[model samples]
Target chain A: MSATQTNDAPPEPGSHRRGLLWDGMLPEALGLCLVAIIFGGLAAGYLVTDYSWKQQSAAAHKAETEAVAQAMATALGCVADADGRSRAGEAPDVAAGPRTGRPSEQVELLMRELGRLPGLRSMHWTREGEAPAEPYREGEAPAEPYWEGEAPAEPRRDCSMVVTVAVRTLGGEPAGELRVERSASADAGYRSLLLWNWGTPTGITLLVFVALYRRLKRHLRPMVAIERNLHSCAQGLEQELQTLTLSDSLGRAAQGWNHLIEQLTQLHQRLQEAQGAEQADVMARFEGAVFRRVVDRLPIGVICVTNSHTISYANASAAALLQRGPDELVGRAVDKAIENPAVMQAVVAAQARSGAGLSVDHTSRDGDQETTLRFRILPVSAQSPSGDALITVEDISQLREGERARDNFLYHVTHELRTPLTNISAYVETLTQPGFDDEQTRKECYNVIVSETKRLSSLIENILTVSQLEVGTARLDVGEVDLTRLVRQMVQDNLAAADEKRIDLTLSLPPKVPKMRGDKQRLCILLNNLIGNAVKYTPAGGQVQVNLEVAENRLVLAVSDTGIGIAAEDQAQVFDKFYRATADAVQAVPGTGLGLALAREVARLHGGEIHLESELGQGSTFTIELPWPTSDQKVTR
Target chain B: MSRILVAEDDPHILRLISMWLKRQGHDVLEARHGLAARDLLQAEPVDVLISDINMPGLDGLELIEAVVPAGLVRRGVVVLTNRWDHGEIRTRLAAWGVHVLPKPFSPSRLSELIESLTSSDVTEPQA
Candidate 1:
């Protein structure tokens, strides 16, 4: 019927306060019963009091009337005794007169006094068989209906009481009858019942009920406050109960709520205080989740091994570096993860050493493929009895190759200087020997000595040139040189050498080749190298041709010779300093290996590149392409 | 007379070596470069080898690898080089039956080294 009734089933089996009986109607029934009890009590009590008042008043009226009548008889006897003890019927009748003649008057006076009783209507006397002794007194009887010829059967039947008695002489003889009458209704008793029992007690009970209900409502205020606070808490918003300053049972209930909230607040604080420790645990969980992914992305290969060299973990980097899957590297022996003896031994040695950090350079073989690596090992969780060691590998193959190239370059520089000097000394010493030479041999020895000196100087010069090119210190002497004239001059100088070898060295010029704008001496060196290599590498009866053409806004100088062409394998390295072809013609030819390297450097200095095309046992064509200069050129005499 | 092999990249040095060795009463073979020297060693069993370290193709180490591995050149090897960093290689070469002759060595010095290397009493037969 109400919202409260929705959950007002009998409390759960173990709950406090069972549901109210008759759907919580017992209190209402009790209230109704109380009202009925008060009403019934008042009504019944009013009726009983009214009824008893009537009965008792009537009985009292009858008793008082009888007593008065008896007293009248005794007075009549005394009057008779005084008149010589008159007998019952012999007594002087009060209707006649007493012997003393004052007795009649006295009887009248006594009758009037007896009529003074409350609710008394009349008092009278009569002779035995005669009429009344006197006429009725004024205001005595009003012709009452209750005074019938027969007596009333029940007290409620009449509202009046009448009593009669016979007078007796001193000898105890009956004389005259005496009678008294009074009304039985007591109105004052009815007024007392209404004021005392019915009205007053009902007003007091009503006042008590109102006070009780008001007190109950006051008690409920604290309960409402507590419920409001508890509802907030149930909604996940915490609020402490306000302390009640009362000293009643409701106050006790408020105190209980305040104590409960205080306890809850303390508990919440204890939970909040544990947050920092919980944060560390949460962070550790996060790291555990992402650790593998982060490590897999690292550039260097990383492997983790236990103290016993058991491979515990490997990231993707380690897996790829070792040519295996990340999962495949796990749970194997650390030595098996890397089979290179040097690297394996280095890891073992690093682990065997005590400190946390260790590093070693190792060369590992992937089958026939050798790779240089740098290994760095770190021991994690070192405080634990059996800690894991982290091994990282960085490939240093490029760095090692660079160092090897540097060492080879130094060796070449030294050898180029030393070879000619060795020959010079040997030739000079040979020429000085006593009788050691025929004139012809003597002349050849002197010639060898002079040429060795020139070779030594030229070797020094080439070294200086190579060094200058490497360090970017070579400066160009800018000038203009006619390509037609320069080519003819270079060709003429090489013609003698070509004739000695019987090579048909020829020069071709397009009608309009662009005049070159660059350092004259460097250009001469570049041209001399190109033409000289052609002449030197060509066998007897082979042809060497040089051509200069302008094409696509650039000058292309091409030298083609029927020389021993470069092998496919050696073509890439042919331009390196001190490189010489292994072909028979190139080996037999007497020229420093620096020629092609120097020529390319000179071409590069002029903002061009040299392109070579050749097949083994065929001929090579060297083409130099330079962008044409747009500005005016200077001509030197 | 023991046969000696001389391999050098420079023609003048090669000639100078050949002439001096001829004066020392030893038959000498001349090679212009490492490839030529490797061919000469392949053709005959020379007693001693005088080789240069720096050559155009198939340099001194390559020649040594060819000859020494086959137990050719029985009278031991003489490595001639102008390289200053050849000490480590020279030590390895000497260990493997080769001797070092730095470049600029005089003909007189060359004769002395040849005398000592060819003299059987003072040398171990290169194994």
Candidate 2:
């Protein structure tokens, strides 16, 4: 069967054939047809045999009647003549006399003489008109052969024969018919032979039909078992096709189909395994790539360690910060990295506080350079049954520096403001006293108070601005501005302060100073602060010069002054908040130390840097570098 | 007259405490930082010592530690700070019989603490 037809029924074990004999309509129809054919053949044979026997019996009976009728006619003629001779006074033939011989004997004698025989059991023979010798005396006629009237009548017997003729003695005239009687033993013998022959064959045919039915059933037993097995397979039961072993082609076909099914199932299983393996490979690659990139790109130092305290992984930042290579760090115990007892105590404490996961701040010293590190230990579990852990190390050295700087700034600013506040409060209190009510003294005190208020406001504003810039919250209103013009303007604005201190302020600009993209207000503020710092720090007779030069793709500005120079030790910390030079502190300069720090922050916001070059007693030079943008390269801020 | 050294950064607080002590007929010495207090203690023997904890360079805790060995502050040491979480201060000062008075202390409270320390039995080393 084709797949399309098999779709109508449930699928077979291996092929589209119906599993059971009765499962398909066609097989059932064929079985019914076969039964009908056998029964119809048997019925046809029975009808034919019955019809032939009836026809043969009828024909035989007609031929026997004809023969018997001819013999009876001869016998009756002989008897009638003998009786006529005796009645005509002539002596009757004694050998064939009717009165002395039985009718069967007389008929036989007559037939032998006449060459025709009569039926068997014919005892008495009488003429058609002859009466019994003992005639009926009113009601006493013989019961065996009685005559109702004196007339020529037909003879009656158990078996009888009759004869008729239309003739006169010498001329053609109607005469009485002569009849004879005989038994039918010959017909009975013939019927018995026909019955025996017909009955024997019928019995044999019935027996043969029964044997053939049993044989056919036995031969189809395997087919029935095959059907039952196929039904079980179709119903999702486990069918053992191996059990259907036969030395026939159908058994081989079944085995081949079963083999094909097993192969298909195996192929499906292998395909699933291949797909699963491919998916696992892709996931592993993806995870490895992601982990590698993240570890490499992290800015902070990181180190991972196993639960047994062996270092497993270290990033470049961690290696560099620790003053070692990544390979040297791997497989090393975490405690050996930094040998500070305090740091060790902190790590142990954090580990004790948070099992397997810890965050700690500790001070570490690498040779002469001391750094503060923040360590975070996170426990990671292994993918499989073998458990492991990953510990992460982060170096927060810069963060610690920034925090220290901020704390120092707060402490110094508070201290600086407190001095002025105390001075102002004291003066005001003194002025409020009854003895100090002079207008000149009062005006002087008011002036002092205003100046100090301005100083306090500027200090607060600078601190706030620097903090904003550090946190990346400060917005720059960037635009195209000429670097030389801005620097010259800053110098001009600070001319009075320089003149008061007797310092000569000069500006030098290249003829064609390039324009740069920057925040105009922020740049102006930065230049003013630098120039003002020069004027404030320089003593009398000091010279200050502002110069602008156009470098490649950038505009560089330099401000140099011959004033109180910063010491080498304080140069690095000059941009730090509230940091004053040791010399300047001795001189007691009247300026907040926040100017340089604020200037550095402004420069950083413009993606520029300020480089300071100075020596003791030889004024410092501050240089600012900014990127120059072409007309098309400028972006709106 | 007992010469008492008061090492306090705030001048207002110094003046108020000094005025109150002078009114009570005691000689009062004022210093703004730990260095000044050290200088003053070296010059004169103070009968009592009063100091603030948070100061530049050397704080009150270091001053207390320095004064005991120097034998300059002969009576009792009074430590003052604005910080309430002074468990470390208290613990470190316990051996020296140093009294930790939390800041925002009134002038009367200072006088009372000093009187209590001076008037008590000297053998107990009042803190």
Candidate 3:
């Protein structure tokens, strides 16, 4: 129902966390943070350890100096006693070794004691105011010592400290100075403890991290599975998300994802079902409303055939025209239905003709009736290969009969006019002959001939006019005209004709009638024909009535005649050219039988219709309806 | 006077053609159909052959095909027909150095065709 539902995977828990984890850059950030903590702690520890080590080394160097100073005081006291003293006034000669001075012997013993302390590589004592000597050892040269008035440098080994002390006799003269060197190895030992202190915790941390990673990975397995399934679904695969155990948050996430996928699948299925139903409804409407109700109900036959010459569909009218059932005609060759060679030829020619359309006349026997079929093949290229063809068959049998009747009427009329015309020509020729005499007789013959000639001319002119109307060549000059005034003028013009027939011609027009848009001459002809027919059909003392009224959106002109009316069946054929009713057969009515037909055609050319209402032996009323234009009609300048 | 051959099926139309030709001071020979027109050409010489397309037997195209190669009726030919949309007819007529005159033609059109055919010394008119 929402835009995201149509576009993306449904929302789920792992997707939400994965989105956060991606934003947080978790693994790289954790690794970098851990590395920075470890390195920063190591650096802080190194600096703190080094500072403490330097202080401890300075204390050790100070203690070593005091011990050497005590040893030097004892040696000086022994030398100051003067009992058994050496002649140089140094110390007593207490031992008989190669290098056994009391001060050197005592200094060597004190250096060995100082060496017993931890982190002491070597300890030595040097007497000042002498050549630099090594610390006195029995079998080794005396260790080097600092010269008097020279400051002792600090110990050089890492984290080591150095100290020196000066001793003097009671004579205010310098006896000797003691020098001590000590290393800061004890401080380095403490720093090493801190370095190895991280080992156990690191190992434990790694073990716990591995355990947690495996646990998290196990918990996320369902999420990964759901992800893969969702990917497949996104690609239009039908795989469903795996079921979850629902024991933890990740399990719940997987469960939620599975539920969402189920909901989406259900929605999609319902959408597909609705779409299918809609398609079926559309198809039903097309088949019911368009194909059956309309095409089948039409009077003209309709056959739709493919380019491969197979009939795809046929209407009921087509089945009737072809004298076959609808099922039998479908999927059958169109040429087999109507067994006419000319129709088949036209079909094949129409298919073969490149651009122009094909039309042909077919005569076929349907039961006892011989029907004339007019086949028109219109190529249907609206769709592809086996591009269809729409074959419309019109039953023009009645139309042919009407045309034949019109031709017969024209023939008879022409023949009838020719007789008097021939006689008049003969009379005029005789008068113009060389042996002719009598001017008065000639003049009388000429007058009779002229009248007869005029009668023939009028007959021919009427024939030509009707023929032009029937053939659709009559161009009506359309414009607005007053219907009441036009009808009044027509009635007055034909008053003498109505008087001769002794029919009471009446006009019943409203005081104000709407102006009609039409050709005045064609309207006059139409009105004249209707009025003339009314007078001709009515006997003496019969009544003929003409009325004009405005109906809804149209002007209706009704002409009612109290004459020998047409039968219900014959009323439909009255407007057909040259169709004189059977009732008029016994009556000696003289007419060209084209007046109503021409009038109907004239009304049709002006976008109007004509209807006739009549009953046998009662009367007839002919109504002509024309649409009235609105008052806002504008004329182009 | 030039001897002109006229081939027409309708007798009334053929008589009218012959009368027109005779009035123009030319000797006219007539045939009822295409086969008779061909026979006439084989037997005698003609200045031009004016024929109709839709004859009973041996239509105008076939007559032109027969006489054109045999050196019979070496003059020009003018075909008249009611079928105005036959593209094949026009192509075949042009191939045999023949001219086409559409149906419902006037008398003056026929006269002008005759005068042009006789006055031009060329055997075939350039298309």
The best candidate in terms of DockQ: 1
Query: Model 3 lDDT vs. the true structure?
Result: 0.66
* lDDT by residue (tens digit), candidate 2, A1-637: 1121111222346543554564578556656756665566556655555455546644554466556545545445555555566679766565434555543345445544543233332223333455423333445533322122222233221233333332122222222443333333234544454455555555665567668677755655445545555566678874333433332433444445446545755786798899999999999999999988898778777776544556677888878767797688888877787554543444445444444565666676779877776666554443423233444456677777778887776766665565456446555654565544678757766776676676666667776787776677887776777776778788888998788888999988888866767778777778988998888778888999998888777678899999888889989998876777655222345455778888888777776789999987888899987666533234323
Assess candidate 2 and give its TM-score to the true structure: 0.46
lDDT of each: 0.71, 0.64, 0.66
Provide the RMSD of all predictions against the true structure, rounded to 1 decimal. 16.9, 16.5, 22.3
* Model 2 spans with C-alpha error above 4 angstroms: A1-366, A371-403, A412-437, A480-489, A507-517, A547-556, A568-587, A590-594, A604-611, A625-637, B1-127
Shift of residue A542 alpha carbon in model 3, Å: 11
Worst 10 residues of 3 chain B by lDDT: B10-19
Better of 1 and 3 by lDDT: 1
Tens-place lDDT per residue, model 2, B61-119, is 88888877688877788887655456778887888877887654545567787887666
Judging by TM-score against the true structure, name the best candidate.
1
Chain A TM-score from candidate 3: 0.36
Candidate 1 ranges with C-alpha deviation above 4 Å: A1-294, A340-349, A356-374, A379-386, A424-481, A485-504, A510-514, A576-579, A588-594, A601-609, A630-637, B1-9, B18-100, B116-127
Q: Native contacts recovered, in order, as a fraction for each?
A: 0.70, 0.00, 0.00
Which portions of model 3 miss their true places by more than 4 Å? Answer: A1-68, A71-362, A366-488, A491-523, A534-571, A581-593, A598-637, B1-127
Clashing pairs in 2: A103-A123, A128-A152, A159-A182, A160-A182, A167-A173, A168-A173, A305-A391
Where is model 2 chain A poorest over a 10-residue stretch in terms of lDDT?
A1-10
